[model samples]
Target: MLVDSHCHLDFPDFAEELDAVVDRARQAGVGRMVTICTYLSRFDRILAVAERYDDVLCSLGVHPHQAAEEIGGVTVERLVELSRHPKVIGLGETGLDYFYDKSPRDIQQECFRRHIRASVETGLPLIIHTRDADDDTMRIVREEAAGQPVKGLLHCFSSGRQLAEDALDFGFSLSLSGIVTFKKSEELRDIVRDVPLDRILVETDAPYLAPVPFRGKRNEPAYVAHTAACVAEVKGVDAAELARRTTENFFRLFDRADPSRQAAA
Candidate 1:
């Protein structure tokens, strides 16, 4: 079993073949996937997709890249309010991303703080997305998360050792993505090698970061196996064990999808 914990199935790349994509994921033994929400305007649509599929779950909150659009009138209370839905299992894909700087840096930090507050209040782990901004990312996470006992996973992790250590210290999980499979991702591969199994997760960030053999193509939930294979290689564990561990970690983190409730779905 496996879970693609971070994917954007709602993106247009999967629009025409959503059912096929879901079927492929099922065929690949992907037990579950979380369609990340990048903005509130599209959260409803993504939630509907989750509602439509028995194997898929959804998260609410904007990506840091969209901070400029999110600044006005947004509040942590609002995200908490939305999370009452059982299908909404987490609070993000939110955090800082200076690589693109699509949105203003300060605004991204503010948006990140809001989501952290909501995660703290609602008891849902945040799914952070940091890139080329490790210092700011760790600083904000540490400061805002102070005394909050926040839970989260840094999705698509490609940061340095110090940031990884700090995040782990704060009781956070680290998720690996397609990037780990790249021949040039020796650093990330090393991280995968060392990250404790119980504190690690796997994702595709699908319709985006497909693993090798399909690199540069549109990613889907099905390609998560490649990532699992890569992690297995890095950690010197069997692929089956890696799959089992990540699937277990997935359910543990997104505990809202308990068997009885999901079975009813």
Candidate 2:
């Protein structure tokens, strides 16, 4: 079985045929998925998706791009409180995004730190979304995790090798998205080859980056298999083996997700 470790099912792209979309994922061997919440205010919608699907889980927290808007609202206490829901398995698709800078750099950093604290407190793995801010992201993760156990994954990892190495050293997992299957992602495929199979996860970040053979089309959890196949090829492993390893890694990182639940489904 395969798990799409991070996605946004609450997004409107799948609103019309949500059930069919999920069925397609299951048919494609994607037995599980974690629908990430980018906006805390819209978390109820995310939770509804998880509640509606037997194999789907959800996270709580805001993305860095909306840091300014959710400043006082996206608190560690609030995140921890919402995470009490059995279906809520992780925290934050939160991290720095210097490429867009939709929010001030300081706000983004502060928001990220808050989410880290929530992850540390709740024992829920953090689903980080970092872009064009590797130095700050690494520094903050290191600083926050200092002398304490912090669990998290760098979701949709498209950062530098140093960041990948640093995240691994920090006992964090790296999640590959459909971006890895692109023709120009040869360097990324090289990075995948170096990543320990036990520390890798796969995602589609659906309604966005779709894998090759389906690139430029609307993405969904079903396309995660394509990304996994590509990564498996690069790592010289059978696609099934890669799927098993990644599914194991996903369960390891997001401990709240009961593996038996997927089996029951």
Candidate number of the best TM-score: 2
Off by over 4 Å in 1: 260-265
> Across residues 1-265, which tens digit of lDDT does each residue of candidate 1 receive?
8999999988988889899999999999999989999997678898999999988999998888788897674688789898999889998878888889999999999999998888878889889999898888878877887886788899998888888988888788999999999999998777777789888898999888789989999899999999999988888899999998888888787778667656776
Model 1 alpha-carbon miss at residue 136, Å:
1.8
TM-score, candidate number 1: 0.96
In model 2, the clashing pairs are: none
Candidate 2 minimal-lDDT segment of 10 residues: 256-265
- Cα-based lDDT for every prediction: 0.88, 0.90
TM-score, prediction 2: 0.97
> Judged by lDDT, which candidate is best?
2
